[model samples]
Target: MKVPFSPPFIDQDVINEVLSTLESGWITSGPKVKALEEEVCKLTSVSHTVCVNSWTSGAILVLKWFGVKEGDEVIVPAYTYSATALAVIHCGATPVMVDINEDFTVDTSKIEQAITNKTKVIMPVDIAGWPCDYDAINELVNAPSRIKVFNPESEKQKQLGRILVISDAAHSIGATYKGLQSGNLTDITIFSFHAVKNITTAEGGAICLNLPESFNNDEEYKLMKLFTLNGQNKDAFTKSQAGGWKYDILFAGLKVNMPDICAAIGLAQIRKYNDLLLVERERVARRYQNFFSQYSFFQLPILEDKERKSCFHLYALRINSISEEKRDLIIESVTKTGVSVNVHFIPMPMLTVFKDRGYKIEDFPIAYDNYSREISLPIYPQLTDDEVDYICTAILTSYKKVIQSND
Candidate 1:
């Protein structure tokens, strides 16, 4: 009856792919990585994709590529994982924290208010695999008023003449917004293939490039590949070829390239993602909704609506009218029943690093509200129907106990 939270779905296909990489002798950032990038482009219909060691690395690379440097600002939701803000910090820029909407996506209205002359990028996170409002966001950035206020310091920024939008799509690889996939919905989108993600590469990420027509995506893809490999004109795989030993360093770049071994894992998973893996996750989420809806206290996560479809990465069930303390007690009770659960995140302002940097939880009221009562239930593809029922029962019983004790 034990229900673990978000285990990576590893079947025979994943194992065989990894085994093949190990046998190939070229297990570094080679064919497998390239293939995974291509597969991601095909799935998301993005023009170009660059695989990296992790989402943080990919974000930093993209931020740096867009000329985000010291004194620049990037707008991000306070509700997201720290990595989103940390990427901006690594580039010596500040993260302008904004609150989120009830659906767990960054509030577009808040983003518009946060924009300033120093704002270089707007990173909207897709919490729990739900896509954000890209159409509104895109229009906001491109609006003549916003562009007029933009101060471009670098050559790249000057070329674009406006703020950039990067989708923090770590949880939303398969999600769709207005019939377009998450990756294709933004100027650039980064997808995480972390261990617990819908598609796992053990530990990896991909940057989907869909810049405006003014910029060449194919050229940017070449530059991004070099950026991930220490700015070397040739990668390890290319250097392994005959007479390719000597190469030039274009500039100081990051060593964040994804190895073939890790890419192989995600490669196998994504091939069957749309048809099989994503469907099962959605099915489990629907079952949880069905079980929890009858109770007044249970608030179900929105899986889809008329405009968007989520990847159903996390079943972020919320307990209505409960204090944070009561939510903790309920989680404690549920754990005793052998159901492992989690909180999506603690607001950035509430965390020590951001707090010390002078951010206040009071500024992000909505983010705090969502964080307090949110409980991320397991919704992986491999979860069985029986396990889903057990998990729902455990939560119901635990909530009753906590309520009685508080009363």
Candidate 2:
């Protein structure tokens, strides 16, 4: 009767892959990692993939690669996990937080107003596996007025010629927007393979290179590899070759390379993604929607649109018109009933760190409104139908209790 939030689907295939990796002797960022990157390229239809230790690392690497530093600005949604904004801060750049739409994605209409000569990156997060409107965001970024506003600081930025759209697609991998996969939806997209994500590699992430046609992805991939390995000229795999001990230091780089061990899991997960994980997650989500639709208060997470489709990563069920206090009460009651639920996020301004940085919750009304009532239900490939029913009943009962108490 106990329903945990999200657990990695580690079957025999994952274990065997890891076992083979452990036996291979060359376990650190070697053949298996390369294979995983190739598989990701095939899955997302991107030209290059750079596997990293985490999505935060990948985001930071991209920021560094484009020479985002002190005084620059990176626009991000206020509703996303702090990683999105923290990536900007780590690069010594100011994170210009923007409010989100009702869909819990960045409000593209307001993006242009936030753009300035200092704006270098616009990171749109695909919250809960649902992709934001990339086409709209892209048009805004590439608009004539906005392009004129951009002032390139680095050689890489000048080459790009405009603001770079890096998708914070941490929750969306198998997702689609306007018939394009998550990676292809933006100029560049970073994916997370953390344990709770729809597809997991225990703790890993990747940067899908989808830069503009004028940019050389292959060259960028090579540079990223160098940047990730402490600015070393060669990785451990390359140095393992005979007479390859003499390597040169390229420059100061971040140590965020993914090892073969995590890549082993990523390979297995990506291989079986569409057939098993995606199907089961979608099935569970549909069942939840069917059951919850009978209630007036439930505002289900977006599953699909004409131009977009979620990977069904998280069922972010919302209780409309509820106060933050009542929402917490419902979660408490549901937990007592043996079903665990979690909020997708707390808006940036509400967080103590960002608050101290002069961001006020009142500035982002839409994001805070969504955050107050959102409760992410259990939706994973391993969840059973019986568990789904139990979750529904618990939520309904708990929600009614909170509503009646308020009345």
Candidate 3:
């Protein structure tokens, strides 16, 4: 049996939604996009949400809105996907890479040390759908000592008087922390709807606005919508209305708006996610946990604890006491069995772009350790129980073969 990793869960419902959008004839940032944003708002309980073409776009838009510019710094985990750091780079700011905890989330303690007056934002990624410690992070930014060091250069920054927290929740839409959803856990959170994500719009994302009460999320939503459409006061949907043809460009903004056609796909998936889809994902993860626990070499990922529950986006299983070379060989062996797997990421510091920017992988030992041993297993709504069993069996057999050969 051939097992594919993380295929988008496209069904008749998704098809119908797309068909409906096509039939409507208004596909570009129309009612479907608005509806998808509303559904996300409901799921996350955030006051407002703005849909964008991609997570990177949403992150850049948010950073720009906060006035992050040259000489500014944004703190991010070295263990995350490159998009997190790339967003900061696009805004002409430096990405201060921090080490991650064993659970794969950013180390909050390490983050405090990285803070400087130039620090404008702290982007904590929910690696593998597990929520980070937002409470600690929020407190760290809001602490008097930290605030005293913060020298606000922009009007937006001065108004807040602290570093903004943006949750890179690309893999953790449904995840919960201390009874709060991932999107609502930070000052702002961005959820990805990429093809491989738990919720797919083919390629799309949403920015959940959960700023403090002093800030009007509704006004912020309007500004974000404008920013996604080249700073036009009116969107295509609104301009389609009679007498709305003429509009003003307030400022230069990125054209990263989500079209209705793409939003249709995610709308269908997210509507049923919490009830049926998410449950199945959790069930499959639990099965993997049960099967892998008996093996001495398997290090099961943390799915849940006393205060948090993951969305089970990626089943990042780690092989204990294995060198990076052995892990690659084991992956090769597993692939021969017709099972598709992947590594979550290589540390950002190890990547060419960041390496050239003076980042050393040695600075983030934990991030490197996590990346070396990590193997992301196939975990999605469509993966059947039998397929999962086959995958587990394939990995175990391949591991034994690789170990015996090396011995």
Candidate 4:
């Protein structure tokens, strides 16, 4: 069996939705986008949500919305996808990289030391659909000493009164933290619906707004709608209406709005989320854990606990104490068996851009340790029970072969 890494769970219902949207003749950011935003709001229990072209766009939008620009600093984990830091760079702000804990989430304890007067945003990534310790991270951001260090710029920044916490929740949509969903866990959260994500809009994302009391979610939502549409005061659907043709460009903004076609896919996924996608993923993850727990070589991903629940996006299996070279060989072995696997991320500092910027991987030992030995298995909703078994057996065989040859 050829087991592939994450694939989008697209069904006839999703196809029908997209077809309906296409037939309706409003393919741009229209009613379907609005409907998808509403569904996300309900799923996350957040007051407002704005669908964007992608998670990268959503992150940059939030940073730009808060006026995080040149001279500002944003704290992000070195263990995450580059999008988390690239957003800061897009704003001409400095991204101060921090290390992560064993669970692959940001280390809350190390966050404070990264804070400076220039810090404006604290972006904690929810890697592999697992929510981070938001309460601890939020407390750190609001700590009196940390607040004293924040130098506000825009009115939104001043209103927030302290460093803003935004979750890079690209992999985590249905995941929960302290009985709250991923988006609600932080001041602002971005969810990706990329092809490989648990839910797919082909290439899309949403911004869940949970800012402090000083900010109005409704107004924020409207402003973000404008931000995503090239600052156009009205959308295509609105202008198509009677006497709505007259509109104006509010200001220069990014054209990152999600089209109705992509939103149609998201609408279908969110509706069947609990009933199908989330449950199937959990079953696959549990099965992997059951099979791998007996092996000394396998270090299982943190599946779930009392304080949190993962959406079971990726089963990031780690090879304990393995060097980077052996890990690569193991991956090669798995591929030789016709089973595809991948790394969750390469530590940001190891990348050429960050490395050239003077960041070092040695400073993030924990993140590097996690990255070097990690392999993400296929855990999409459509993987049959037979395929799951084949994937597990293939990995176990490959791992044993690699270890034996090394010895």
Candidate 5:
């Protein structure tokens, strides 16, 4: 039997909930969507949450709402999906990519080097469901302005707003970092509820406003609400009101609203989250650690190490002391044995767009080394013990064949 990689764990509960929503007919950003947003609010302990169709849109919208525009620079990690940097570009801002630590987190030491007078935001991605060092990032944001920032191109002179810490926490939804939820760890946190993510909303995302006391997220929320729906003053809720059909165009906001269907799926998922889903994932992670503990050729994903707890999103195993070519061959071998797998990223600088933008792969050596031989194994709540065993067996058998062949 073939074992596919991560898939949604839908049950009768999820099906019934979705059907109930379908039958309700008050769908498409209605009461049900509002309830889901509230549920997210409680879960993250954040004051405000704006649900969107995807994490990319959430990230982009946050930057745009914060007035991140042309001539502004945002810092992003090199060892992340292209979406992390692409969203910054969507806001017409420059993405200064930084290298990652040995654990594949955005290296805190390197972040300071990329800051300029043009730097307005620091977009730190929770790579592999682990939070980047928030305290270090906050310190950088609070440091006395010392980066001799100069502006030559702007006629209207742009000033940096201290630093906005944007957390691209696509993989981490139920994750906790330093006794705080992932959503509450930064200025703005964007979560992915995609099929592959820990929390599956099918194809959706949420923007958490965990701002300081000075920043009132409610006003920003209204703007974002208007922004997502064609820059109109009224959303579907207001338009549905009696004699409130007419609305005015505020700003040219993009269409990125999440429907009740998507929210229904998310609502269903969150119901059993603390009761069952997170526990199961945690168990599976421990099992993987136990199984791979003795393997010298393997360096498992750093989930719980040196003060960090991952959401266990991806079982990224590093091919210790192996060439990238051999790693490819090993992955191919595993695939032949009825197990499905993939890689997390390809280091943005190596991508065509990033390379063309004058970023060199050599600039991020640590990120390159980490990416060269990492294979993301199947990880999801639905994965069973038998399936896990088969996956592990296939991996070990492939490793023996490849390593022995090389020896």
Candidate 6:
């Protein structure tokens, strides 16, 4: 009856794949990584795809690729992980935090208000695996000129009037909104292959390039490759060529390339990944919804009327009719039953770094409110039907014990 949240669903196939990769004697960012990247491109319909060590590296690399420098601001949702905001800071850019819609995707309405001149990138996080209003976002990001800066003599000297749209598709790797996949919906997208994700590469990610018309994909991808590989103009494979070892350093780049060992696992996962993994996840989610839908305390997730199919990475249960104290009590109760639960995120501004940056919690009431009452239960491909039932019953029992007492 013990159910752990998001235990990776690795089978013998994934294990055998990695073991064979070890035996192959070519491990560091080689053919396997390229094959996986090509597979990702085929799945997501992205022009170019680059593999990195983690989702955080993919996100920051996107900003770095587009030349997001000091004094620039990148728009982000206040509800996402610290890595999302921290990545912006890594690029010497300020994270312009925005609120989310009631359904938890980034609020499109609030974006215009936050965009001033220094805004270099508008990063819309696909929170809880549901994509945002991309059409609306695109219209705003494309319309008119709005690139204000600190000094009139800055990177405006480099690229002008061209703000980028980056999608944090970490949770929505297999998700689609309005029939378009998450990666293709935005200008650039980053997908996570962390242990807990739907498709895991142990700890890895892919940066999918869908750049604007002005930038050439070849040039952009070349820079992306150089940036991830110690800023060298030539990678190790190229340098190993007979009498072809000469190259130059473009910028002080970050070493965040994905290894072939991780890619091997992803390759196996991607091969038979469709329908089988997603269908099981949906079935589990539906069963959880059916069990909890009748209760006043339970507000099941909406997939925006079936036009959008969430990857169902999580089913975020919210006790909105209760206090934060009661929410904590519920978590404790769930824990006592040998079933583990998790919170998807804590609002970034509440963290020490954002607090030091003068970000107040009250600014993003929706995100804070959502975080307080939310609890994400185990919804992986490995959970058995009986186990799901046990977990659901445990949740209902906890809700009754904690919330009824408070009521």
Model 1 accuracy (lDDT, Cα): 0.94
In order, the Cα lDDT scores of the candidates are 0.94, 0.92, 0.95, 0.91, 0.84, 0.84
Can you write out model 4's per-residue Cα lDDT over 94-126, one digit (the tens) per residue? 999999999999998788888889989999998
Candidate 2 residue-wise lDDT, 171-224, digit = tens: 999999888898988889999999898777788899999998888999999999
TM-scores for every candidate against the unseen true structure: 0.99, 0.99, 0.99, 0.99, 0.95, 0.94
Candidate 2: pairs in clash:
none
Please give the TM-score that candidate 6 achieves against the real structure. 0.94
The deviation in Å at residue 184 for candidate 2 is 0.5
lDDT of 3 by residue, 95-156 (tens): 99999999999999999999998999999999999999999999999999999999899888
- Residue 289 error for model 3, in Å? 0.4
Ranking by lDDT: 3, 1, 2, 4, 6, 5
Where model 4 places Cα greater than 4 Å from the true spot, the runs are: none
lDDT of 6 by residue, 255-358 (tens): 99999999998998887667578778888888888888888777777755757889888888887676677888999999999999998788999999999999
> What C-alpha lDDT, on a 0 to 100 scale, does residue 285 get in candidate 4?
94
Error of 5 at 122 (Å): 0.7
For each of the candidates, the C-alpha root-mean-square deviation to the true structure, in angstroms, is 0.7, 0.8, 0.7, 0.9, 2.4, 2.2
Q: Which stretches of candidate 6 lie over 4 Å from their true place?
A: 145-160, 241-247, 304-306
Prediction 5 TM-score vs. true:
0.95
Error of 6 at 368 (Å): 1.1
How many angstroms is residue 185 displaced in model 1 relative to the true structure, after the best TM-score fit?
A: 0.6
Clashing pairs in 5: none
Q: 1-407, model 1: which lDDT tens digit per residue? A: 78899888999999999999999998899999989999999999987999999999999999988889999999999999999999999999999999999999999999999998999999999999999989999999999999999999988898888999999999999999999998999889999999999999999999999989889999999999999988999999889999989999999999999999999999999999999999999899999989999999998999989999999989999999999999999999999999999999999899999999999999999999999999999999889999999999999999999999889
TM-score of predicted structure 4: 0.99
